[model samples]
Target: MKAIVFGSTGFIGSHTVEQLILKGHKVTAVVRSHSNVAFLQSLDVRIVEIDYSDTASIKEEIEGHEVVYNCIGSVGLRSKIDLENAVEIDLTKKLVRAASLSGANRFIQLSSIVVYDFHSSEPLDESYCIKPQYLIQQLLLKREEVVRKIGEETGITTIILRPASAIGRRDYMSFFSRLFQQHMNDQFPLLKNGETKVSLVDTRDVGRAMEWLGNYPFPKGSMNLFLLKGFDTTWKSLKEEIDYERGIEVTICDLSNIVEDPVSYTLNTFRTHRVWNDEKIRKLGFTTKYSQRESVKDAVQDFRDRERI
Candidate 1:
């Protein structure tokens, strides 16, 4: 099978490309000029150049692919100008159109768990509806509509995977990654009580899940879960693990309420608004290879091994 992957140099995209090749599928990796192509070349995969933020650029590169994977997204890193939203929504709309027109077999979208409402107070499934309180979240909610419609209208097999907080090698330095790094360096601050419920997914599982789903034809569309961790990783457990794993004393504070007003607004949103119930997707055929604790240990070691901590 031949496949096309956007954001092929990104954390999730890179892993997807690796899995695709290992499964004996040919891959064409499309990425912006600024993305490092050396890594994709190292995998013996063909590389195409294009920016997903541009419609013509994407439509051109995706013209003759069997499968198109959309993994493009941002997290509070862009300017507040309206153009950012336009870029995001426009690219998604354009990609969905291009894939359908090209007679692609399947369109897989990588989305965040943030689409679930924070007030639900229960485990969320695909049926759980979300009302957007933020601009970015609203864009994803809107993109979902576009993807679902394209599938219905064109009979293209479409799938969306909402993985929560994916982590692995070369990961973007998130609070979670920072936490792991701190433990590795024995400099982890005891931020609020880690009592808040959080979900995690290994970056590796994300690639595995995508490869597994590629076989199932989805005329009606399906959304799957790829959560590798539990609902919460307590502060006590986090600290204890650091001490045991690295043989060092680490401090953990009970700043669970810091989520009320995080140092960065993005973190505040994570602490307060995001929630997901992956049980529905789990039943569909995806499973995680890493738990929160296992992931934390691996994440810490990766950081140390790379940074020489």
Candidate 2:
């Protein structure tokens, strides 16, 4: 199978490219000119640098690929919130239009589970209502809408994947990563005694799921959505796991005293229980390789090995 992946340099995108290659699929990794392709360069695939601002060029680049994977996203936690939201929404609109024009067999979008109204104690699935609250979550909801509309109008097969918190190597920007880093540096923040539940999925498993969906045969003009959930655990349990792995007791600070920063906002996400039911995808023969504890352990070890602590 031939696949074209946008945002190939990102955490989840990088793993997806690697998995596709390992499965003997022909991949074209689309990246920006300033992207660090050191890892991608080592892989057996075609690397294409294209101007994201030019929709025509993006369309041309995606042409002839059996599957177009949209993983492009903004790492704009530190930037102007409005600008970041605009950029994300605009890019998604362009990608959907470009993929539709390219006539790809399937368009796989890497969405987030936060789009769902996750206040309920029951697990969320594709049927859950979308009631995004945060600025970022609102933008994601809009992005998903654009893809769905375009896919329906153009008669293209669209698959939307709402993956839970992803954990593994190359996830230095994730909330869990930041929390782990703070814990290592003795500045961890304790939220409600660190008792909120979090559902985390391994990056490799996310990649495998994308690959499976990309290769799966969908009926013509089908629009499918799935939630990818990993193992579930509480923040306290995760912290204990980290403490046991690192052989040190992390200082847990009062949450109220911690200044409002990106990391703080991230930690606050667990103030509400976030869980998803992925039986829909599981029934499709998709399975995760790592448990939640193992996923967190691997992420911490990866950071340690990189000497980031």
Candidate 3:
């Protein structure tokens, strides 16, 4: 197998690249000029640095690859809403166009589970209609639509993977990472008494899911969407698990006292139950290696080993 991975320096992308290499696939990783490639330097893969703003360059880089995996997206607790919109909307459109033009056999897109409406108590599936609330959520919804539309028109098989909050090693700046850090510093906030449920999946599992879908046979001119979630738990349970694993009782602050920021916007997401049904992916023989408890323990230990906490 030959694959090209964009956003290879990111948390999820890095894991996917590692899994692909372990599966004995030839891999090419695309990154930006200033991206830190220290972790990827020792991997058995080719690394290409290119300006993503150049569509022609992206098209050229994507050519001759059997599979193109797009893991590019905005990260952080806070960002310029406008900048994020452009990256999720414009850059994604460009990548889809370039991949279709490059004649890739399959295009796998990394989407978010947050695209589903949060008002429902039942777990969401791939068939759920998108009702995004935040600016970032809206951007992701648009990205999914654009990819499907382009794939349908170009006769390329497109697979969309919407994974829950992915947590694992090397995820230094994700929401979960920041939450762990804040807990260590005694500054973590609890929203609505931490009653809302959140679905989570380990980055390794997410990577494996992508690898599985990459090799799965998709009928010509078809687009498939799968929701990937390992375990579902309340915010309070997640915090308790981390505390028990670390042997420390971290203080949970009042959400009302926290200042309004990007982090606050993210915390607002947890005020509602956001769980997804993984039966769709499970039917395809996808199994998660780490449960929610195991993932939390591993992530906290990784943070400690890296001296991040």
Candidate 4:
């Protein structure tokens, strides 16, 4: 199988490209410049250089691939959309348009579980339309809808995978992963009510899910792929684990004392408590190799081993 991946040098994209190549599928990794080239080269993936935000260029570059995986995403939060193409309307539209024009057989859009508004007492499912609260989440929801429409109208076999908090070592850390790093280094000051629960899925699991979809033929339409975050962990537990490893309780800045950067600690940590439902993904033959504790522990260990903390 010939597979093409956008943002192939990114955290999840690089991992996905490696998995595809290991499975004997020739992989074409999209990169924007020389820095992107080095990372994809480390994976030994075929490189295609194009601006991810450009439609005509992406269409030209995306041709002749059996499947295209939209793993492109903004790495972290920001105040404005133009600073980075993080906003969904501008960012996702480019990818979707390219895939539609490319006429690929399968389009696997790697999306976020945050699309569903996290207000449910029960586990969140595909049917739930609570919508995204924050800026990034809102953009993802719009992107998902547009992808579904393209699949329906053009007969593109579109499969959407919404992984909850992808875990594993990569060139960069995720929004939460950075915060976790901060917690480990005593850099995250203002630890307000650290009770918020987080659901995590190993990046290996994400790779497996992509492989599974590549092998299995999907019906002509769209499907929501997700791993329910059944297991939940708190920042306090994460801190405990780090403390056990380092033999020193990392300093957690007082929550009560407020400052300008309140969102970094207080607001973000408070909102991460929502759980994700992954039953849909399990029904499709994907199993998580790492349990919540195991994955988190391994992630924390990686941080220490790499001296990222």
Q: Return the clash pairs for model 1, or none.
A: 124-277, 190-253, 192-254, 192-255, 192-256, 193-254, 193-255, 193-256
Q: Please, what is the whole-model Cα lDDT of each candidate in the order they appear?
A: 0.68, 0.82, 0.84, 0.68
Q: Which regions of candidate 3 are displaced past 4 Å?
A: 75-77, 83-85, 256-264
Query: Residue 294 lDDT in model 4?
Result: 65
Please, what is the TM-score per model? 0.82, 0.91, 0.91, 0.82
RMSD of 2: 2.7
Q: For residues 1-309, could you state the per-residue lDDT of candidate 2 as single tens digits? A: 999999899988998999999999999999999999988999998999999888889999999998999988654444555734487778877887788888888888998875665457566778877665566667777788888998999888999999988888888577778788788788666678888787878888999999999988789779999989778887788888888878888887767556654443354565777878899989988888888778877887888778854
lDDT per residue as tens, model 3, 1-309: 899999899999999999999899999999999899988898999999999778899999999998999988654435656734466778877888888899888899998775666558677888877676676677677788888998988988899999998889889777788788788886666788888888899998999998999999889769999999888898888888888888988888777566665454465666768888989889888898889888988888888788853
Per-residue lDDT tens digits for candidate 1, residues 1-309, read 788988788887888988888899888988787787767888978898775556666676777778888877645533473634566667777888888877778898887775655555455667766676566667667777778887778777788877777767666655566666666555654444444455566777788777776765555444332433344454456567667767788665334455443244354443452445666656766666767667667766776676774
Question: Which is the winner by lDDT between candidate 2 and candidate 4?
Answer: 2
> Among all windows of ten consecutive residues in candidate 1, which has the lowest summed lDDT?
222-231
Best by lDDT: 3
Residue pairs with backbone overlap in model 3 = none
Instruction: Give model 1's TM-score versus the native structure.
Output: 0.82
lDDT of 4 by residue, 202-223 (tens): 7766776787777686675555
CA deviation > 4 Å runs, candidate 2: 75-79, 83-85, 256-268
Query: Which sections of candidate 4 miss by over 4 Å?
Result: 52-56, 82-91, 171-173, 187-193, 223-231, 245-247, 254-272, 297-309
